[model samples]
Target: MFASGLCFVGVTGIVRYLGTELPAVQSAFLRFAWGVVFLLPALIGVLRSGMPGLHLRLHLGRGVVHVAAVVCWFYAMARIPVAEVTAIGYLNPVLLTLGTVVFFGERLSLRRVLAIGVALTGALIVLRPGLREVTDGHIAQIFAAVFFAGSYLFAKRLSGIASAGQIVAMLSLVVTLALAPLAAWVWVPVSAEQIAWLAVVAACATGGHYCMSRAFAAAPIAVSQPVVFLQLIWAALLGWVAFGEAVDVFVLLGGAVIVGSVSYITWAEARQRRRVVMPEVL
Candidate 1:
């Protein structure tokens, strides 16, 4: 999971640099399309299974939302400081909980409500809306997280019916196709250097997901997820050392709060899952 965290930072760092030379939508499209190219071997068998067995609706739904998330994320990466982008990305799981309540009719328990509030409070601290004007980049990242939450919800809906590999593969392929039109519409000249960098982004992003999947399969998500906060530290450090962006103490404090809330939520969900698996004592 630590490795995964670093890989994600690498991915975002590359995206940030490459965003200077290409449109966010096109860069994102290339990332997915390149991911599909690299993942072709793993995807081949799933592809052979035909459209009916692939759960096309869920894949398409996730792909659409994921494309939006990626585009917004890329846009945010270009316009905002990497640390700010990383800090705002923490809203994903919080938003995911809200998405479940809205779309799946899940009950909003008190714990969840508080967790949501804590997370949002953290975001408020980071943004300080009254004191500072929120940039378009900040708003873009928030939107990115919302659509990412939607994508995550769709993935959950598909979990029972598909294998992990299939889920991962379908996301890349479907999202690549979904992003095609946008890429074409806003097409621009991309140099080999830019392509090489986006390729690195593809590798890091995909590799990070693979590492996280392995960690999740090895243990309950509750155990592995907390380590994800390490990414914020790494992102802050990377921003400072690599990009010369100063770390804001408030961003650190807010991110810590957000991570704490999200970590508690993960532990709670894992406990619930264990309860479902274990028989009652009577």
Candidate 2:
């Protein structure tokens, strides 16, 4: 989890360094294009296994949501401070919790509800939509978070029928195909330096997901959930050292509150899992 967090921070730093010189959509496509290179081994593995049949539509849907999310995220990373972007991304899990309740018909306990409320309050503080003029980057992050939540939800559904590697491979293929045209449409001349940065972003993103999967396998979700909070700290430090961005007090306080809420929600989820029934012994 720690490695995943660090890799993700590195990816964000690279994206921020790239800035808005290229269109966000084109930059997002390049990120995925380069990332597909890292997934080639996993793609071969899935093909050799052939256990789960590929669901092209499901993968395509996930890719669509992911493309939108990636575009927004890249845009936000380019225009906003990395720490702020990372802080706003806390909303993804919050939305996922609510989504399960609404879309999956999962029961939401009072504690879970209260926790969600607190997390949203933190988001409001970070966004400060009331006082500050919400820029396009801020709006992008908001929508991107929602799309990311949707992408995760779809991934969870796919996981029921497919191995993680298979799902990831399919997602990569679909994303590459979907974004290829966009990359061509708004293509810009790329220098070797930019290519190097994109390669780093790709490597970090692929490695981050791999590490996250390993973390989940190593520990229960309850244990792993808290590790994600470390990402905000890492992001803040990277943003400061790399970009001279300062962390705001409100973002810290709000992020803490949001983390607390998410921790509570994770505990609740584990408790619910413990209560699930099993078939009688034969």
Candidate 3:
């Protein structure tokens, strides 16, 4: 997952660079569009073998929410510092944990309750509400995190019925189709250079997900989860070097707390899963 996290840093850099040149909606659309294009061959094969998963509507619904989330994310990237964007993104997993209890009827343990509380505290530290006026970008990122939490909740629902690759392929196809109209409506002509940049974006996204899947397969979530913190560090470095942005100490401290909470959540989850499976093993 370390490599995956690094690849995502590259994705953030490209989106931030193009954020100035392209409309956020269009830029978000192009990234997923190219991702779909690159995955077409594999997707075609998956389809040829007979669509593997049930609940066609569920997959499409995920795509719709993902489109909104990604559009919001692109807008935030354009206006906010990358570190701030990364810091705010740490909320997604926490929100996702809460979402399960609310939407899916999953029980929230004491550990989860504490983790959620800490995550919110970390968010407050990061935002420091009265100290700095929360801008549109901050609001957008919050919305994006909520929607992304929803999207991930859907993914978890589908995991029992489908393979990870199948789920991802379906999402890429659906999200691409979902974005096509918006992209067309707001379409502005772009240079081949822009196309090249978006292609790189697609490649990193695709590769990052693939690497993440491999990481998950290779170890328990608790073991691999902390490696994701490297992404924040990388984003900070990229922001400093490429965009001439300064690191915000609050963002760093807040991100560490958020990451710690997320790690605890994942560790707890892994332990729960093992407890559920131990009887079968015996």
Q: Choose the strongest candidate by TM-score.
A: 1
Scored by lDDT, the top model is 1
The TM-score obtained by model 2 is 0.92
lDDT of 2 by residue, 1-282 (tens): 999999999999999989988888788877787777888898888767655335656777899999888888988989988988888898899999888888889888898889999999998888888788789988899899999999998897888887777888878777888888988888888788888888889899988988998998998878888878889898888888889998777777777778878988888778777778645569
Q: Write the per-residue lDDT of candidate 1 for residues 1-282, one digit (tens) a residue.
A: 988999999998887766556888899998888999998997998888766635988899899999999999999999887878888999999999998999999999999999999999999988889898899999999999999999999999898888888899999999999899999999999889888888899999988988888898898878987898889999899889988889988888888889999999889978988899999899
lDDT of 3 by residue, 1-282 (tens): 999998988988988888667877788888888887887887887687765345587898899999999989999999998988998999999999899899989998899999999999999998999998999999999999999999999899989877777788888888888888988898898889898898999999888988998998999889998887888899998999999999888888898899999998899888888898886644
Task: Give the residue spans of candidate 1 off by over 4 A.
Answer: 272-282
Output the better candidate (1/3) by lDDT. Answer: 1
- Residue 55, model 3: Cα distance from true site in angstroms: 2.0
| TM-score of each predicted structure versus truth | 0.95, 0.92, 0.94
Where model 2 places Cα greater than 4 Å from the true spot, the runs are 45-54, 275-282
Report the C-alpha displacement of residue 62, candidate 1, in angstroms: 1.3
List the RMSD of every prediction in angstroms.
1.6, 2.6, 2.2
Question: Higher TM-score: candidate 1 or 2?
Answer: 1
- List lDDT for all candidates, in order: 0.89, 0.85, 0.88
Q: Candidates 1 and 2: which is better by lDDT?
A: 1
Best-to-worst order by lDDT is 1, 3, 2
Would you give me the overall lDDT of model 2? Answer: 0.85
| Residue pair clashes in candidate 3 | none
